[model samples]
Target: MSSAPLSPVALFWRCCLWLILLLALPAQAQFTLGQRATDQAATPHVQARLVVQAPDGIAAGQPLTLGLLLTHQPQWHTYWKNAGDSGLPTELDWDVPPGLEAGEIAWPVPQQIRVGDLLNYGYEGQILLPVPMTVGPDFTPDADGTVRIGLHARWLVCRVECIPEDVQLQVQLPVAQSHGAFAAAFADAQARAPAVSSALTGQFEVAPDGQHVTLQVQGLPAPAQGQELAFYPEAADTFRHAAVLGRDWQQRWDGAVWHATLPLSDMRGATPAALEVVLGLPVAGSSVAEQPPAAAWRIAAPVQGQWQAAQLAEISPALAAALAANQANQTNPTTTAPPASGGSNARSGSWLMALAGGLIGGLLLNLMPCVFPVLAIKLLGFARHGSDMRAQRLGGLAYTLGTVVSFAALGALLLALRAAGEQLGWGFQLQNPMVIVALAVLFTVLGLNLAGVFEFGQMLPSGIASLHLRHPVADAFLSGVLAVAVASPCTAPFMGASLGFAVALPAAQALAIFAALGLGMALPYLLLSWAPGLLRWLPRPGPWMATFRCAMAFPMLATVVWLTWVLGQQTGVDGVAALLALLLALSALIWALTLQGRTRWLLGAVLAALLGWLLPTLAPYLRELPPQEASAASSAPGTALWQPWSPEQQTQLLAEGRPVFVDYTAAWCVTCQFNKRTTLSDPAVLQAFTLRGVQLLRADWTRQDPRITAALEQLGRSGVPVYVLLAPGKAPVVLTELIRPDDVLQALAGI
Candidate 1:
């Protein structure tokens, strides 16, 4: 028997023979769905099929995709959600089991079709429209292993002339398991479908002038400067889409956020509660390696107070007819300015100096490793459009605004939280477990994005773009946010005193100081923009930029490492493991996106299952704070020279007349980690500490510690990486937020 083992060729023939046998007996021997479960219609210009793509059928509680495959003849076309000046969106009438739920049709990006003087939006040749269907968890499969789903689909197929078509389509599937028959169709549909709007918030307001509406947006990826920013409304008569679609509107972008005024049509009709819009950055001839971004958003808005006189509440048909007849008599109200927030406070000279210091401190922070990576990317962004003065100055200003707003918001939050009685400081946000996880994820995504693993802005499937997001200023503002988020861990020289003073002052004063710091941080870029000649020093935009971007990703990756370590410190090894798993899932999804055809969908579903399985079991950890690090920090990490910092340990060391050097640090503190790796741990510096008999101790402040808090308060500081040097009988020497190698040596030598 061993000698008679089947050859590879023989095995292949045997498998083929079995498949042939299986196919031969399939008529009645194999299971099949009811006759009404599938349908197809054909015409000279098109062939439409309503097929249930599930080959293996659906399992209980599982969701599957149903596809409308429309194969149009050459030069024939189909309409999109908005058919522009003509045509209608495809419609499907669902008739499924009582327990099943069907979702709306997912639209692919449509091409702008123009015929003579009229413009239309639609697709040419073949296209697929997929609708999502789900089964209930409590559903029980029929004994026949079959489930029935039906659709009454209708559309107008066009080629010079339009022919309306209607057909009944149905699919019969086994309820035991999911199959792969429509895998390619589903993939194609999803590849072209619009993605859900991200977490950014936007608001639209009716201006006092009956002709205008202002829209403001916040959050989302920043568009490249001078990029095309636009919004396409889904509703036909809501705004003056015809008139205001082009030169009639005025838009100002403070980074990725927007402030836009749209002129209204002669008749606005009744204002709806909300408007659904497609926001995007239009692709340009000079696009980088990445595609432009487009998102679909439902913006909820209310009419501003100034427009009360013009807003209409439609009455009965008879009254509406009368009002419509008199519509010509209506007059447009005068325009008014927007309202302001917070009262005016006169600026004091002393306040100004403190603010200037904050600005300088923030600017200096750019040199810190914590902020360097993101800033590098931002600098590159600025340099890319250095030739355009309008873009350069606007980008710079928007970035400054982003920084100041973030800082002010942080300061406001801190003051509010402090006013509520809980003990908190400048870096208190890091103490929260959720914040830690969020920052880690953000850092990881940014690194991956920079490395070209995926595009941040082009989140939608092909064909979606934000007309408003194209203003490159969004990137500048977002850069400001990134800078502040990362730089929190490190306190630069001159920053500590300024911050300490600011935190102790009134809310307005504190916010002012924070603003000043942001302005200072943003000043260098502003100066470069103001002086266009400096832009000449930058390397021209080309392939090298991509390489440079990839290189910068590593530093961001390094930052993520530190953040992960910080998370471990705050949440323990188990929490770190959970977070890492989430990251792994995210990475898998990212990779899945790069694939095409059926493989992309099949793999995505599997990976999504894995992530879904993991989230419920580990989600609680996001809210779970770590146990105290008091005992954990006591153990020396790789080196015995440093000891855990504590009041008792410090008192004992000082009483023994042993000169002490304390490193007040945190895992999240980038400056602390930077100094530890570069300056403090230098061979000469370690040698100097050893020779001085200085007992070096580390005080970890990753978690909230009353003792550490007291230590910082006593020193008149409110942040970490505060190095203190003490001699047997001398006062403690408070080194600057940032220290030089010589500063350390001199402090040790004198103390």
Candidate 2:
């Protein structure tokens, strides 16, 4: 300032000298590793902070603790040392003055988080990583009596996507002779750090084939009364965590203690000396039911199964002895594991029980509405045979063959569909709209035949009748077929359990069960044929037989009407119209067959052609319409109080602490209708439901619904009239197939 400013040439020379000196400075100096506190962006998802976290002054030879804290956005996580299926663990490069020693990081227990199909081990939210350092006499304190450390860190933060991050952090601390300000915080961090558990001392070793690691612990007690155990591995890429734990996916829990075999992965490069895992045990606590006390263990797993030699690396001798003593106190000598999947895992029904149940159920079908039409045919034929045991037995045998073959075929189709991954069950054939429509058409024709529209046995030429649809054998066979078709939807007493067991069994076993059911249905008729005395109960065939036969046609027509309505339910109004039109066209052709000569043949051909063309068009249109409102959904003043059932609604009612009574019904199930009219709709039953505050839910499988199918599976059932009573926080009580008034009342009283 005293002299004049320098000339341009002199200024340029001075600037060049200053630039040279700046360039000569060390890179560390440029990085400035002397700051007391610093914040750096580790990644887009994470922010890192390095703090001295030390006492105001440090003793020359005393140990000091610091923290490398990382705060991440929600859902973003940083990997643990061994990052399961993927990701890299965070690492730090420390540059400090001479004579300063740094210890290994004390890692906290990491959580197992699954991403898509892969499992990852990492920490979410904020974590303060504790780093211990010791000062030696050779370590020089700065002129300001400060201690400094230069830290370079690399980490990865991930959510659905990952981001790599690095930070050059410098932290400076003042030398102090006393303890640190955050001594309690440091101690807490140390406590949270993972250490080998002595709670249950057990050996961990690889399988003999080296394909898996087996962890067998005999001393670990059941977590508390209502608690379960959780397993977590500590090493990175060492095990197939996701594939090994939970699901029916190779995990098995034995009763004595937990024995799990974890399949090894080839991704882990080398075999480490030890394996680390964490076990979460249930302990009593005031909060919730109990607190889960999680402990980590470092196990010395050798190359092979010298299980007794490997010990828990972090346990004390006293704790190990306590675990051994606890295990010895139990009386159970062996362990038992639960069965695998729901398919074959369930206990199977005994063959004798299934056979007996099917027989009884089939016999009961005679009393049901659907079987009434067939019953009329059977009784008429019985009178026609009149005490001739030999003739009756032959007819009975033919009928039995037809019935058994149909049942066998149904069973075969069920097994085939199951193998093809279709989630169908008993009565699954009815779930298809085409099957429903076809059944309707067949019933319609059967009704017309009963009404005398066309006589197969009486009117057809004897040559044609003997080998085709008109022979006595054909008549008996058709009668049996009709019986089976009508009887299928009605799942009688004990039938649900037996059929459920049968469907889950092998194809041959399942078919045998179906055959038994057919035999049961035919038993009464077969007995009447074999023993002549039973026919004496009825009057001899006479003029009254014709009147009775005509009268029986009404029931067949009644069934046809019901089928028409069912068709409407399945395919709206147009489907019903199409079916009725087809019936009319077919009837005209059959009527033409009764007329004389060429005229009859020509008229019949025209009608047949019309039907052949019309049937194809109808078949194409047999699509399932949208589900309509169920009668149960509405609580109109004159109607009984009930609600439409769904899996969600059933679950919701149960969760609300309201007792629920579910009626798994279908329109095609005649027994279900009978029960609704006689028992469920009775005043006493209604009063019981009202008194018990029962939420009545009706699941109508009149049409296809996968939810209903799934629900049936849960109940171990395959057909309808399955009445389940659910009480608040209690196991469901399944009532008998036939819902009598007293059954409902008694079930409600128990609830």
Candidate 3:
């Protein structure tokens, strides 16, 4: 009894402790070593608050001051805009009345604060940030002769782990005949603010080849010795983990303005939108009030270069050919360097890697749950003929060859379609309702066979079954066909790269890779057959064999179910029903083949063949009921926000300044669904998103959605469950397909 009570208490304390720690964590970053934020309230840290100087409202031409006040509890502090290495700088969002113009933040030069080995520039005790604003020439005063301004401010306050905060503020002040009581204090603060020259400007241009970024700055002072140059992006998403690469300071034609070329290194891509580049100096005789134009500058315009090592070779040969033809069509084209041959290695490497990748991919494909039942059927057949090692070996080899040929045929067909301008990929076949229906019927028939509703040996016209099974070449061909059918849903990890390469590579290389994959898949079964001793472990054929065979039908039935669902998604309920009817008909045809005599079998085969040929042809004309779409929890089913996948959504989200979380997922993908259930669906992560007002956009590829496919291509991913988060004013960070709760939280926080 005592222990039981103690257990609950312990559990409660554990939960409370975890919640406290989680809540205490800095949203923008992890608590790293030697990092600490200043404590204000009895903790020697300061609290940063955002406030504006508007009372009710103000008139045009009224000099307005916006203040970001940092109230230290006592002795603690916070950093300025250029928080050296690992501290937060103050930034704000201001919205004023129409015709009102505002200048940049008048940041006061801050003290150099040292915490461990990191150098941070900030304020301690207490500090106030001021911004000057005024109305346009054509302006009117309100009835109360006042103006109101709204501001959204973000700043990093440190005590241990830098804690970032977002605060909303609105202040109203009357248009006065004289200065208010706090006006002089604000003026004194303004005098201490850094003086950033209005003429100073910086422009960034990345090399076309993407190897370097050159920052061109105008009207900037020469740096003093030992002055460390730094840049803060006005936009947070511009770069990550950036450092100065190279700086070249030269005098521009404009008097006294130096053109400084600062090269950035280890940029890791774009800078975060939250920051602006601030070039700091250790020059003597500069006060906190005199650090503006000479101290910090905003990037006049942001620039990014397109240079991915992997993408250099993805240049379309078709595009190149088109360009060449256009040039040749002209009467006199300017001479240019011969087309570089560097692409040859890229093409060849892609092809060989694709082949090798396909082989490895095939081996992994064997592990998919979707393909397991079909393989089991093949192995069971082998077990039945354990004594005939040669027959087993031949059957296995034949299967491998069959798979290879089928893959080659499929690859050739896909390439042909591509040449004809059909946008497609490896799994594109599954998008056709007729194909889905056909596959469904075929599997159902196989299921019926395994269920033992018919005896093929007795019903056949004596010689046919013997001829079909006995001929090694025919067996091998059939095995190949079966392997291709079973390998569809099982996309191994490397298959994406291989398939993408195959699509872009020469026809012969693509075919070769496809064939290699088939061979790899079939290798295991062939080896098993070669080593007959492995079959000795199987139980002898009896009642149990019948039970096992029947049991195997369920997996096929499951496949049928999945195909039917896919059909519904692609076309509609009508399509699914049609598929179901066709499956029933197929079962009847198989049952007919099991009738006692050869005549019945022949007739059944004829009917089955005709139906098989005709149903697919008829599928196109069938009308389908639209599938039901998923909706957000609060939304009514029909009126929910379930938009089809589109690049437009991404653009719109960014434009609206709303944080977005995109889940690239599909219906037929089991792993994707599993991830959704176990990780994405976690309540803690969902609540965090909901509370933070993060928009959840799902791109469903359940059926082939072209836009979603294009998005996948953009990301260099060929499959579903690709997660991405775009935060307001932050660079988009991609999350792994297999998500973790902590990972989701961190990404959302970062954004």
Best by TM-score: 2
Scored by lDDT, model 1 comes in at 0.64
Name the candidate, 1 or 2, with the larger TM-score value: 2
Ranking by lDDT: 1, 2, 3
Please, what are the lDDT tens digits per residue for candidate 3 over residues 365-447?
Answer: 78877777767777666656658777777777777777778878888888898688666666777655445655665666566
lDDT of 1 by residue, 1-751 (tens): 0122121112222323333432232221111111223566554456777755555457545557787888888887878787755567788988887667888887775655555544456777678888877767756555787777777777766666565555666766677666676678777767665445456667778776656888877754554333555455666545554443347887787876777787764435666666666555545553211232333334444454343322232333433332222111111001011212233332244355567668778888778777777778777776577488888888888878888888888888877886886566778888766667666666666666667776532344222223213435665676677677777656776666566656667888888987887787787878887888878888888788878877877987887777777787766777788889877886787678667779988998898778666655565444334333332352234245777677757766766779888888877777777677777768788899889899988887777665787666555466777787866555556676567789888777776
Backbone clashes per model, in order?
Answer: 22, 5, 54
Q: Which stretches of candidate 3 lie over 4 Å from their true place?
A: 1-357, 457-460, 532-536, 540-543, 585-643, 727-750
- What TM-score would you give candidate 2 relative to the actual structure? 0.51
- Residues 1-751 of candidate 2: C-alpha lDDT, one tens digit per residue: 1222221112222323332432232222222322223434344466777655556356665667767778889988888777777778889878788878777777765666678887777778777677888877888878997767778777878877565556778767667545465566567666656555456555566777666777765544444222444456766556666673346224345665666677765444456656656655423342111222454334333344422222222234433333332222111101112222333332242555566777777777677776787776787788877877777898888778877877777778877987887677777777655556555655655555556665553333445434422356655775677677767776666677667667766788778888888888888888887777787887898888767766776887787787776666555677778768866876687688767779988998898788766665554335524333432332122244777787657655665788998888776666677677788778888888888899888887776566787777655567776787877644456677776788777767766
- Listed in order, each prediction's TM-score against the native is 0.49, 0.51, 0.48
Error of 3 at 415 (Å): 2.6
lDDT of each: 0.64, 0.63, 0.56
Summing lDDT over every window of 10 consecutive residues in candidate 1, give the lowest-scoring window: 328-337
